[model samples]
Structure formats: C-alpha cells, structure tokens
Target: MNPTDAPFVPGVPAEHQPATGSAPGTPLALYFHHVHPDVRHYTALTPREFAEGMERVLAEFDPYRPDDLLAPSGPVRPDRPTVLVTFDDGYRDNLVHARPILRELGVRAVFFVCTGLLGQHSGQPREDYLTWDACDRLAEDGHLIAAHTRTHPHLDRLPPEQAQDEARASLADIAARYGPGPARLFAYPYGGIPAEPGLPGDVLAFGTVRSPAEPWHSAPQAIRRTYLPSGATGTWDGLVRHWRAQWQPAGATARPDDRDDLRGERP
Candidate 1:
C-alpha cells in the first residue's frame, strides 16, 4: 500500500509515549490554498463557504496554531480534539477575506509563504499574492507566519544544492523578516516531501496526507496534514451526502433528505 494510504499507526517512541491515562487525542491538521469570493481553484473557498466550513470544524475540534505542537514542552492537551488550519503559497485573499472571517470566529491560522514570490504580480490582480507588509501584518495579528521555500519549487526534483538553498533560504527569510522563532515551522510546497531531507533538524516540516480521518502520528520533523476540500464537494450539501453514507449503519439505506451537517454529532 502507498505510504499516504497507510493507516496512521501510533509510533510514539516508547520513551516519549504519553504517561498512562494522558494519551493524546487525534489532532487534525488541515491545509487550504486560496480563499476568495470566486472559486479560483478546486482548493479555493468563497468567504461564506470558508466561514461555514470553519464553524463545522470548530464544532468537532478546538483550534491550534503550529507552534503549539513545535514547542519544546510538546502540544497542549485541550479538553477537545485539536485542528490546525493553515494556508500555503501566501495568497493575498487569505488576508483580505479569510482573515476577517477567522478573526470573527477567534481562530488563528498559519500562513506558509514563499520568500521569493512576495509582491510579485503576474498581471492577474487576484494572483498578486501577499506582500512583505501583508505578512508582517499577519504576524502582528497573531497568526503564525511560516516558511514554504524561497521559490515554490518541487524540492524532490531539484538538485541537492538548489534544494538546500530553497529550504534554508525560506527559513532565513522568515527569521530576517520576523525573527528566529517563526523560522522553525515549515510546510512543503505541493505537499511533496523531498527524497533528500533538506531542512534543518530543528525545523518542524509538514507534508499532506489527502485522506480524511487517517491517524497521523506525532512525528516532530515530518508532520502530516489533510487537504481541506473546497468548491462543490466542500459545501454542506455535498459533504452531507458523502458523510451520510459513511455514517449510516452497515446495511441501512440513507434517506434522500439525510441532509444534516452532523455538527457536534459523534459517530
């Protein structure tokens, strides 16, 4: 079976495993790309749709920032399960639309930026991406601004030296812009974990696992995140249809109007 398809077996090294009765609950990490009024990509979410999805997420899990896990003391054990919401490629709409909705909902998310691409416009207004000042404001707003390489290249395909520069320069750029603290967290561009491990040991890098509800063990250097779906399949209507099938009794037929979003409903 593919590693991405494999179940998340708990591999907490014996010495680091939680004490009896203090075992950690599953922590879901989700990554989104664009949040615009228009659906720019399948990963894009309109502001209204984004807000609704966040509400649904909150009903099931408490919010967590990336550093909450990267801290030396390990992640906090909240009363509920945790979810870390993150965005990649540093799109401008994240600050424009998503920020207001998240601010209203009291959730702080992580924004992984490519150092080289900031403020470079490609003629398309919406694709202008985030500026350095924008990223500074995001940091000031209490959102974690992390690294996503200097240029958004496939590290696995690049030459080793180039890969090293791409990975290292991103961290350096974050540190220079903000400070050393934010440099420790990273998300691989396009969810590709390079065959050559380019990042420093101290950096906690994240790649994505696409399947939902998979168990992701707490690996400090190699964290796994879920790709939050958007567009048609992201709406409540689309999700309810899929979830109803998953939650129904083994032989029970799902009714046509089994349309509940299942908020706060545990299976």
Candidate 2:
C-alpha cells in the first residue's frame, strides 16, 4: 500500500509509514538528543517536561529494553503497546538529568555515543559530552551504550571509503572500550542513512524515519524512529496529536491530512 494511504500522525516524519505486513506489536522507538534543564536546542527537553512525558508514556505502554525488543529470547506479544526509548549524541545531561529520571521511572534507554567525543571536553556548558568512564557507569546502571560513528558526520556527504571507515571505526571503538554486545548496535549520525542501507558488518542500524520498526521487516538496515519533541508548546502539542494517532482504534482509518509537526525544527 502507498505510505500516503496509511495513517498520518502529527509530529511524526511521514516519509515512512506502518506497513500492512509488519509484525504485530513491533516497537515504536523514540529518539531524544538533549535533556538539559536549560533547552539549548529545539529538540532538548527540560527535566520536569521529560519526566512528565515519560510518565505518560509508561502509563500507556510497556518499556522495551534492548534485550527484550532488539534480540528477544521469547516471542513479543502481538497486542502489546511496546516502545523503546533512545538517546542520540552522548551528552553529560543524559547521566546527570535523564538517567536519574529514567531509573526512577523503571525505564532503561539506549544511548548512542560518538566514540571519538567520549572523554573529550570543549569547556562549553552542557556540551562536555559523556566520557568513557561515564559510558561504563551508564552500562553499570543497566542502560545500553551503542555506537553513533567515530565523529558525528553526514556519511552521505562523504566519499564511500571515508564513510565506511567512519562507521566501522566507531563500532570497533565501542567494542574495544564498551564490549562486543553494545558494538553490534549503531545509529547514523543525524539519522542520515546511506543508499546502501545497513553498515558493512553485522550491525542493526537506525534512521530518523519517524515510524515503528518490525521484527523481521524488509528494511532492517534503516530501522525507523520517531523524534520526541521537547521544544515549545506547539511541538509538544504535535507530539500529543501523534500519540493519539498512534493509539487510535485498530481498525480506524485515518483521514488524509498533511501537516508537518516538526516543520521549523528541520531545514
């Protein structure tokens, strides 16, 4: 079916839609960047706002950890409202602000870090990203630490060989520091997926497609993800509308409506 014919949810990038053949109860993963009290960027969420939003989600859905959803030993329930929480770009706020809240809420999230940036300080407030020690601490706290690229770059804009090195190097970096388990998972910098799709080696990669991922979906390389907006009131409103669209009656057909919930945030 044409993706356009599928449901359109506000705040969600409509480039990818739920497929009819998708596995039942496939997870909807939400990606966040910064969770600082002072919102430096549009995608950053304040501490209070992040807590409240997560609480609301917990009320309606079951948390899907990497083990349960990514590489499950048991079969996933077809009717479960399963969701995975993910944070991109390793930031100190994730450990200081986001981690405590998530721990309190009993939700474990996946953190994708740029291997090269770990332990490097720029002396900028709220920009002194996570160190390797912090990443180890995060893992100790039961959260998964994955690779995001050696240095966050637009792989699409680089030569194929350089791009391949960037991707592979990061995975190797994480394995050397973190371990092989975490190294298996990777996310493209800026959610940019190359034409070839998945990375060269055995890795489950993610992209910013704003849709739920199926267990054995055809596009395994580009696992779709939705952004959890934490900017202005309008962005939150769009997120709420998208949540409603996602949880509508199973058989309900959505009216054809086209509105960009994350319009201004993107160039």
Candidate 3:
C-alpha cells in the first residue's frame, strides 16, 4: 500500500481514553511535522510509534480542547493537565496518518497549513503535502485548521509590509479556501516569534518550545509548543519519558540572538 493510503486501524477508544487521574495545573501543546510508515525527516514518526505516543499521553493528560486555548476569552483550565496536538507545515501525511490516530483516541488537534504551499508537490508526488480538499476533509472531521503563513516565510525578517502581508494573506487564504470565521490561529514559520509579536489583527500565534501554557501570561499572540522529538517515537517508554517532561514547565533553552526571524529548511 502506498504510504499515504495506509489503513486507519482506529485504536480502541475504551482502551485509550484519557485517564482522569492526572494532577492538573499545566497545559501542553505538542507540535509535529510529519507522519509516515517509514522515517523521512528526523521529525517524522511512524504510525505505530505515533499511536504509542498518543496512548502514553492519554494515560496521563486530559485532551485539552483547542477552543479553550484559541478564544481570547477562553478558559484556562490549570486544574488538571491539558494537551493539544498540533501539526505544522501542511504535510499530507498529517491527514493520512495522524488523523486516524487522533480520531481513534478521541483526541482533538490543531493543523497549521501554509496556504501558498497547499496542493503543491515537494519535488516528489503531490501527496507529500496537504491539498485544499484534504484540509476540508480535516475540517469536516472536526479537526481545527489554522494558518502557518501564506508561504511559510520568516515573518520577522521580511520588511514590515511584507511581514504583515504574509500574516494577512494566510488568514485570508485559509478563510477563502476553508471557511470564514477567523481561521486566525497561527504558528510562526520555523517557530520564529518576535519578542514583540502581534499581527495587526486578532490572532493566536504559536512558537516552538516546551513549556507550561503561559502564553497568555506572557505573549498572548504567540503560544509555546513542545516539539515532538524524533527519538521520542522510538519506543513507548521513550514516548512516555520524554513527553512527560514536555508536559511540565522547564527553563528556556538557548536562542539565537537574532531570534526574531527563523528560517525553515523546507517551506
């Protein structure tokens, strides 16, 4: 079977439901780039490994609803641990592989897509990245579709007009292609969130990092996310061990002095 057409053996939800046993107090957002049967990028995780990671997460954390995070007036539930799974860069495998795992586990996730790059091939089969129809299917399936920028540019480095245009054009494109009710949630390209980050309009932007859900306390526009490390998917134990630390707060890692603009290897 083609990797994109891998069957969705939906895991048993009764067996994988989020346990009510976690001590609440923090929120975690996990961001992934790809999911394929075989490893490609260091960020790619196989379906089985992805499922294992989800199982480990379900065993401990409550699946935090994205609405609660996206809404400016949304409730911040710090009582018990909450988690939101997010996939960035509009990869096609996100719909093919990741969706089924989430569906079976009763997990709700946010998918950030680059509007300009959707429906285009990445030097190979067009299935390499998401298309408009696939994105629509995800929206229909109850997953959230948000913006990652129109061309996945380094927003901070662009001239002010171009930077704002990247932000504005993406939100407009997602609304035009998807639906039109503030598809304004965003993930900065390459996780570059300027220290003074804010779109001219209302938006909930995301930065790549591991931390407690303290975006509102600090930067409301740019939220923090825990990158799903490549090796964490090697085993269920690895998933549990690494992801658990990812759920809690930690000291900030070193950032480039020119942290305002981040460039990605692949747009």
Candidate 4:
C-alpha cells in the first residue's frame, strides 16, 4: 500500500463512527523530540504538558513497548486502546525531563539515539545530546534504547551507499555497545523516507507520520508514527485529540459533513 495514500478506513457504514475510547485496529505509536518546557523550540513539549499527556494516555490506553509489537505477536488486544511511545534524536532531556514522569507512570518508551553524539572522541560535545550513560539508565529503567544513526542526518538526502552505511554502522555499533536486542529497532533522523535502499532486511525502522498501524501489522521497516510537537498540540488538549482521536479523513470520500477532529500536523 502507498504510505502517502489514505489510511485503511474500514467500510463500516459512514454513519457508524468509532467511539473515542474504542480500540483502534492497531496501536497508535506516538513520537516526540525534546520534552522540556524551558526550551521553546517548535518541537519541544513542556514538562508539565507532557506529564499531563502521559497521565491521560495511560488512563485511556494500554502501553505496548516496541518489542512487543515488533514480535508480530498474535491476539492483539483490540478490546482496548494500545499506544507505543517513541522519541527521536535522544536528547539528554529524554532522561532529564521526560523519564521521571514516564517512570512514575510506568510507561516504558523507546528512545532512538545517534551513536556518534554520545562520546568525546565522536567530536565536539553537544551537552544537550544524550550520553551513553544516560541511555543505559533509560534501559535500566525499562525503556527501549534504539538507534537513530551514528550522526543525525536526513538519510533520504544522502547518497544511497552512504545512507546504507549510516544505517548499518549505527546498528552494528549499537549492538556492540548495548547488545542486539534493542538494536532491532531503528528510527530515521528527521523521519526521512523510512526506507533506505540498502539497509538490512531485519532492521525495524520507523518514520514520522504514516497513518497509525492497521490491524495485522507486519512491515517493521515502514512502521508509522503520530509525532507529537508542543507547537502543534497544546500541552493538554492536543494530547487528548492526538492520543484519543484519529486524523480526519482526506480522500475523495471525505465529506463536508465530517467533523474536523484533527488537522494535518505533519509538513
């Protein structure tokens, strides 16, 4: 199916709308960047807002860790809401600002990090980036520590060979350092086209936004996410709209009578 096309909207009678709390056919994987309040970058979400979102989501949906969903496990609980939390770029604030609230709520998220940015030898330090120690702490606390790449770059913009190399090297380095389990999960920097021409077949890569996974999900490399940005989603209401509602339909069939529950958040 074309990722750019509309999501698989079941042909339940057009009048038969799914309730806000009804289980989605698949989990809604939510991705985020910085979670600090003081840094008002367009993508950053304030701590208080994030905490509030987590509380609401936890209350409404069952948390599904990346590994659980990637396992192709059967009997996906369609009786209740399911959500997968993921973060890109591995900012130190993931450990500093986001972790505490997640830890308290018992929600284990996946943090995809750039391997090159963690150490002194890698080059000049970006204090805002995460350290290996911090990732280890995140893992120790039950979060999935995945790879984003050795350095954060738009993979689609790189030469095919270079893109493949970046993907492979990061996977290898992450496995060497953190072991192979979590390394199975990869997230593209900038959520560039999720597929690199030559990355390993086994790598389960993720992209920024592609409709939430449909039931019977099997394509790990093209896993879709609903990215959360404080700029687009207010701290509280935005969380409810995103985590609780699906994007409004956009195909030829989308009627003028359809409610605008959610607008396009991705560029």
**Whole-model lDDT per candidate:** 0.65, 0.66, 0.63, 0.63
What would the per-residue lDDT of candidate 3 be over residues 171-193, giving only the tens digit for each residue?
88877766554465778887766
RMSD of candidates 1 onward, in order: 11.4, 8.6, 12.2, 10.3
Model 2: runs farther than 4 Å from truth?
A: 1-24, 69-79, 197-201, 210-216, 233-249, 252-267
Candidate 1 structure quality by residue, lDDT tens digits, 1-267: 121222221433342211111113435566788888765664678888888888876775667665564555334333345568888999888898989998998888889999899998654635668999998888787898889998899877888888888989999999888787788788887666666767875666777652223222335445666543553442443332233233232454435433222111222
In model 1, the worst 10-residue window by lDDT is 15-24
Shift of residue 14 alpha carbon in model 2, Å: 7.5
Which segments of candidate 3 are over 4 A away from where they belong?
1-26, 70-72, 75-78, 122-127, 177-182, 195-198, 210-215, 232-267
Please tell me which model should have the higher TM-score, number 1 or number 3: 1
Residue 207 lDDT in candidate 4: 70
Deviating ranges (above 4 Å) for candidate 4: 1-24, 70-79, 120-127, 210-218, 232-267
Rank candidates, TM-score, best first. Answer: 2, 1, 3, 4
Candidate 2, run of 10 with poorest lDDT: 258-267
TM-score of 3: 0.73
